[model samples]
Target: MFFSKLVMAALAATVLAEKTPVTPLLLANFERYAAFASAAYSSDCANPPFNSTVVRYINDVPTDTQATLFRDDIAQQFIISFRGTSDIQDFVTDLDQVLVPCVAQGIQCPTCLCWQGYLIQYNAVANTVKSAIDAGLLQYPGYSLVVTGHSMGGALASLAAASLDGQGLPLIAYTYGQPRTGNQAYANLIDSAFNGTMYRLTHTNDGVPQIPAQSDGYRHHSREYWQSDDPPTIENTFQCQGQEPSDCNQSEPGYGIGNGGIGINAAHLSYFGISTGNPLDPNAAC
Candidate 1:
């Protein structure tokens, strides 16, 4: 009887913790960040409701990797977002998954090896993106610097965040439906660099987050924020503490079966009750 009572008390406490109401500011930040990620899918990069405006639009013909530099004056943020897989070349980048030594100006992790594809993609635009970020910060010296994206874009943004670190600017990254980005060493480097500011948002049953499988020596940086429920509300959002959490999204049905980005489903299409990562979505620009 005593053991059973103790178990019930523990369960009750856990339930109470989950029910903690989310602050409006926190929810709005996630929604605004999602809008930025979605905007990368479109050329407008405009969001009036969030008081954001496109500062620059990058379309590198050679690499065909697009990025948007936008600012949310209300949030005091200068954000750079990457576009997800859209062309045949992007798929080629995704499949070229060889792990190579990470190259980032601010990172000095000698043993870190990241996905060759992502590194190459970041390299193509790294200088331009850095210049844009530097200009934005120079004008608005107090503003925070943010990097964000979804799907393939998210993968590149993760690398950008690592490369932007230790630059004397306040840097944070938010990635949605991002794939495994690097080997364990690279993951450790990112995990340590961002600390509390990195928000890796994964949704329920989103198979895209499962591959470049662990067997392939790919690993994700911590800490991940998983929305376990369908609508991905504050109540269901939990910060997964480890590099990989078995009881979180990784434990979802057949998630392990995802290979070569094959298990990608509708969950990857949208985030936070809105459709994101779609290039043609008419509302994505808002």
Candidate 2:
């Protein structure tokens, strides 16, 4: 354990140094990306911001998981979103925490290992999501891709972002109340791929990110945007030092572990003061 901490300390230093060079985040964009994350819950996608964008499709054929694809011609971006846990299937997905090989075609992670359930969630819609993204890109040339999700949807967003990285597509991921999706190698893969563009936001006392337990061989990727105080605001948020930084959300005992890795807590429910819905309506049906 001592030697492991030393290694992680050295790696954290290196990751932090290189992290300064990535694209700058616009605080205003947090609200925008968050809007998309929340929109994933609305069944009809008739929410305010979503209503304004060109809706591509909402893939929920499995009913267990759902992802949304849309185009913002004004911003010239193809945005994809996944809804948080609203079904028993998603809870089952979250509980199936066994580590597995990330062998999804196009992902270059030869040695990477990921949480089984999260990868399954990603695989469920990977083909359709990619196809929609490809079509959207072709239709709107020069537009980049953005992926956002809350809770389990956040886990899917990470997998989707990694998948996009494999395709060498321009992309960014903003996930709220996300869990640890993989091991150190998997986290490193994502950190290297997006540098600063991977916004893994954690709200105060959010239990989700605390498990698939780090003790179980899962490690979060570099950088964490933490809301250290309640009533989350730009002023109260802090960009943490490195992957799994102790000074940020890691400072508090999260919701996931206390419930034995299941059950929803308030912090995991609403991000940026928006109700992402409960188990009854994972998608807000907006």
Candidate 3:
């Protein structure tokens, strides 16, 4: 009787913990950082909330490798965020995948064909981030590292995060509109590697997360945070949905495909807690 009572108490406590809301400040910061990741110009880099210094900015135009490294002194953190697809090259990258040696050891995984373009970019950027971390820690002690991106950038961030896995630091990744980066083996590798540190955020009706299609054997990391509103009028509406193959993303009706064509574009651009402006509007037709 006593043990049954204790189990019920513990379950109640867990439920209470899950119901606890995310703070406004953290959500605001995520918005700012995500927007910062999507920025295209040096002028766009002027974010006041962060006394941000751009450590490295790479724009190998039209090939889906536009990434930036910023040291946020205000937050005392380093953010490595990638920008999404902007041209034909990015689309090509999405279509291209090649089988590479599995990242996890002793796992006789199937032939996994990871995103080729993201793999190349991750290799180069991972080295830069490591070097920066080694140097930055001396300059700014106790600073944490955050990896983030949108769309194709998010895919690259996932690959980069996997590469940086097992490093002796608490790493956090927040990716938006990120499509699948690899097969089941790669997804499992990330789950084991990053564990609880990776958060994949998807907005309602967002089509990007639904493809390069899971039917192709691509899978997403667990613990997805879903936004169910358009323009996101309220705060902290994001709910934690655990993994795919359940009722998340394409699994739900009127979300992945039901949003229609415009919905997909809107979902990709809006980061929910962040701005609602379309990042593709300016150059959408250009």
Per-prediction TM-score to the true structure, in the order listed = 0.88, 0.84, 0.75
lDDT of each: 0.79, 0.76, 0.63
Number of the predicted model whose lDDT against the real structure is largest: 1
- The regions of model 3 sitting more than 4 angstroms off are 1-26, 40-44, 60-64, 102-113, 233-236, 251-264, 273-286
Question: What is the Cα-based lDDT of residue 196 in candidate 3?
Answer: 68
Pairs of colliding residues, candidate 3 = none
TM-score of model 3 relative to the true fold?
0.75
- Model 3: lowest-lDDT 10 consecutive positions: 277-286
lDDT digits (tens) for residues 190-239 of candidate 2: 88888888999887777777776677888889768877666666666777
The candidate that achieves the highest TM-score relative to the unseen native structure: 1
Please provide, for model 1 over 260-279, each residue's C-alpha lDDT reduced to its tens digit, 9 standing for 90 to 100.
44445888888877678654
**Regarding TM-score, does 1 or 3 come out ahead?**
1
Model 3: per-residue lDDT, tens digit, 36-97? 55653232454522557777666654344666678878778887777676666766766665
State, as a TM-score between 0 and 1, how close model 2 is to the true structure: 0.84
The per-residue C-alpha lDDT of model 3 at residue 28 equals 65
